[model samples]
Structures are given as structure tokens and as C-alpha cells.
Target: MSTNERLRRRIPQQDRSRAMVERIIAAGHTVLLENGYEGASTNRIARTAGISPGSVYQYFPDKDAIVAEVVDRWTDALHARISCVFAEALDGPADQLSVRVVMGELLDALGENPRLLRVLIEELPRSPDSRLAAFERRMDDLLTVWLRFHLRGHDAPPVGAIAWMLVRTVENVAISYVLDRPPVERDIVADELTAMVTAYLRDISLP
Candidate 1:
């Protein structure tokens, strides 16, 4: 249930073993979304995986163990996608970066696995601890580094504080927008967020 569990987690070494693990994870994802957490059991996952219930337990201690692996895989991919955007956007003059450019990359990241994201948002928190925590921490780590140097000695609010706000605000908007019905086009939302960020980065006076 806790993130630490993943550190010593079991992994399939042989190709056949790896394939079985993948199948089990895929089944877990499907069952978790379809049946909800309460209904997702090792036995059900094994049935969906075309494997035996003992086989499921051979790999994962319990259902949460399976869910933990699923979240780990997803969060790793999402982190890579977002980090790529940050590298490109922050490589040049950070000031030249528009909200459109930043937001587009971020939206693209969210576009990768909306369903898994929904599961993380809706279900994972029920556990005492979650892999989603790692994902959020990774975002904070990457964004904090970017913010500290992006402005290059320019005057601004505390890098830590504003970076926290930036990540939280953008995450809420991105996730909510994806889950909401018929929200405005991503570009318009990006523009609005860009405007807000630009203004907030300035002194008390706004022109």
C-alpha cells in the first residue's frame, strides 16, 4: 500500500515470466476500472489474465500490489513525457516560452493515459499510501529545478512557493478539464493560464 512496498517488489526475470506479469497487470487495470476497487480481487484478475489465482499471488501479494505495479508503470511514462517537454521549453531563453507552448506539452502528457490517471485520481488514495504520491513528487522535483533557473536571476516570488502553486494549479486544471464534459478547447485554457502565470510572475503593479 505504501510507496516503499515497490522498492522490494517482485519482478519477472524470464521473458515468459515477464509476459505473464504484463498480462496480469493488464487484467488488473481492466478489472480495476470496470469493477471498481472493492470488486478487484486476485482471483478475478487471474481469471481475466487467463492464469490461476495462485499464479496471481505468486507474483503479487494482494490486489493492491497489482495496482501498485500498474500505477508505477503509468507514472514512469507520464514523468518521462513531462520531463521531455520541460527540457525543450527550458533549454532556450525561458522568458521566450509562451504558455501555449508549455501548456500544449503538458496537455499532451495528460493525453497519454487518461484512464489510468482517472484510476489514480479516484481509487489509489483509498490505500494508506499510494504510488500517485511518487508521480506528484516527481512533478514537483522537475518543476522546482526548472523554476529555479528558468528566470536566470530575474526578480520573482520564492521559487519553491511559486513552483508549488504552478504545479498544483496546472495539475488541477489539466486533470479536471480532461475529466469534465465538453470543456473549452485546450488552447483557450492554455492562453488563460499563460495570462495568469505571466501576471503572477510580476511585481505588485500590473500594466
Candidate 2:
């Protein structure tokens, strides 16, 4: 089933019901982070929310459903933050500074909740339709457009290919830094990533 279908439950139509659903999702987030995916249960989430297990069932069919909601909300917030950064970067020259700004924001966003990010990256089963996959594809599209416009007068590889490489490279590096907790400082990593990406784009766009 699609993610939307799997997450779809009895949609709460009233304000109170919507608020209750939000509370359950918040509780599910906490439980998932505290207990990991396997340890998380409907009863545990219900307890976390200070509600009966039956009440949780009213909004979500199962533990997976509740966790899906939690993951969706978290990824949505991350997407918004990154998208804003991308939008702003597009307005300026695609220089080292713009690249650094984007990388810095990415690190900050992914580092906001390391435990939850770890759970999502390591514990959750990913599908092509997953939120993370979708986020990458969106980023790819955005970067492709930016590259095409910026390299209009220069010879360059297919923007699609460059975008694909760049999106994955930057994302995996940021994820590793956040999850692995390397001894290197974040500013240094951001500087290195910016220099690498800027140089690659410049080389590829040369006549």
C-alpha cells in the first residue's frame, strides 16, 4: 500500500479530535525515539500520550501507522526548512558562499534530533515512495534547474546527472556527519563540502 493509505485512519473531523490525533502523534514520536521501532508499541505510545490504548486505536489502526505519522511530520518539517534555504540560495549567485549556506542549514536541520534521525535512517524500512526518497528527488529537481540556468553559457554535463550526484553526495555526507559524530567540527565539514561542490561545478561548466 502507499504511505498515505497505510497512514490513513478514521480522519478526525472535529477540532478536539484533531488535537487528540496530534497528541498521539507527538507521543508516538517520543516513544519511537526512546524505545526504537521494535520496542515501541501501541500501549507504550498510549501511556506516553497519557491516553488509553483504545483511544490511540481510534485515530491509528496500528503502531506502524502511528510511527508513519510521526516520521511524516518530522520529514515534513525538515523539508520545509531545507526548501526555504534552497529557495533563498537560488536568488543569489551559485557561489561557494551559497553552497556553504545550504550545507550549513542541512547540517543544522539533520542535527536537530540525532536520535530520531538515527531511528529514521537505521531502524525504519525504506521504500521508493518513502519521504526521504521523495525529498531527495525534489532536491534533485531543484538543483537540476539551478544548474541548468547558471551554466547556460558554459559546456557542462547533463544537469540531471550532476544534480543526481550532488544531491546524494551532499545528503549522505551530512547524514554521516550527524549520525557518526565525527571529531571534526561542523564548520570545517561545511567548508570542505562547499569547496568541493563549488569546484566540481566550476570544472564541469568550463568551456
RMSD of each: 3.2, 1.4
* Full-model lDDT, candidate 2: 0.92
**Number of the top candidate by lDDT?**
2
Ten contiguous residues minimizing lDDT sum, candidate 1? 198-207
Model 2 / residue 69 / CA error / Å: 0.9
Q: What C-alpha lDDT does candidate 1 achieve relative to the native structure?
A: 0.73
For 135-157, candidate 1 gives per-residue lDDT tens digits of 56666776667666665556554
Q: Which residue pairs clash in candidate 1?
A: none
Q: Tens digits of per-residue lDDT for model 2 on 15-55? A: 99999999999999999999999999999999999999999
TM-score of each: 0.83, 0.95
- Kindly report which residue stretches of model 1 are placed more than 4 angstroms away from their true locations once superposed: 1-9, 95-98, 126-131, 150-156, 203-207
